[model samples]
Target: AQTVTQSQPEMSVQEAETVTLSCTYDTSESDYYLFWYKQPPSRQMILVIRQEAYKQQNATENRFSVNFQKAAKSFSLKISDSQLGDAAMYFCAYRDTYSGGGADGLTFGKGTHLIIQP
Candidate 1:
């Protein structure tokens, strides 16, 4: 089994600035994937970034990036040039690939609410 944790319950950032959200996970399984998903008021889960346990390099998408410390089992998301559109509830998720190709649903963190101010 895997568990995700988001220590910060809420985060605020000024428009055009940068913000980093903290996340950590616990899993005895060596083959797994870590992800950051954003859910806005619209109630859709959007994939922000994903890191594979086997990959030494972190994953990044546009202004979104992750600091992945495999040894520490930490995966943090960094948002640059934050915009109002970025305001959403961010969740950290984990899935074990070893289990029949991850047929089970992902385990998600409680989430961190992000507010962007102009």
Candidate 2:
């Protein structure tokens, strides 16, 4: 079985500052994808960033970035220049390339609630 874990239940950052959210997962397979998704009040899951297992360089997008440590199985997210709109429940997810059985979709963590302070 595979499982994603977010150590922080809630996090806060001042506007224009930076924040890092911690995440870790357990998987026996080598080929997989890791992702970070943000869900605001509207309840839409938006993909922040994604990383392929074979990639050594981390993936980055605008103010969002990830530290993918394959050896330790840790994937952490860093949000720079935090904004009010960035406040949301962020979830870490994992997906394997080959699903021998059926596939539901992505396996997500409990989520870390992000609060941006003015």
Task: Give the number of the best model, judged by TM-score.
Answer: 1
Across 82-109, the per-residue lDDT of candidate 1 in tens digits comes to 9999999999999887566546689999
lDDT tens readout by residue for model 2, 10-33:
999999999999999999999899
* Each model's Cα RMSD: 1.1, 1.7
Query: Each model's C-alpha lDDT?
Result: 0.93, 0.96
Candidate 2 Cα errors over 4 Å, as ranges: 99-104
Error of 1 at 48 (Å): 1.1
Per-structure clash totals for the candidates = 0, 0
Q: Give lDDT: candidate 2, residue 86.
A: 95
Residue ranges of candidate 1 with Cα displaced over 4 Å: none
Best by lDDT: 2
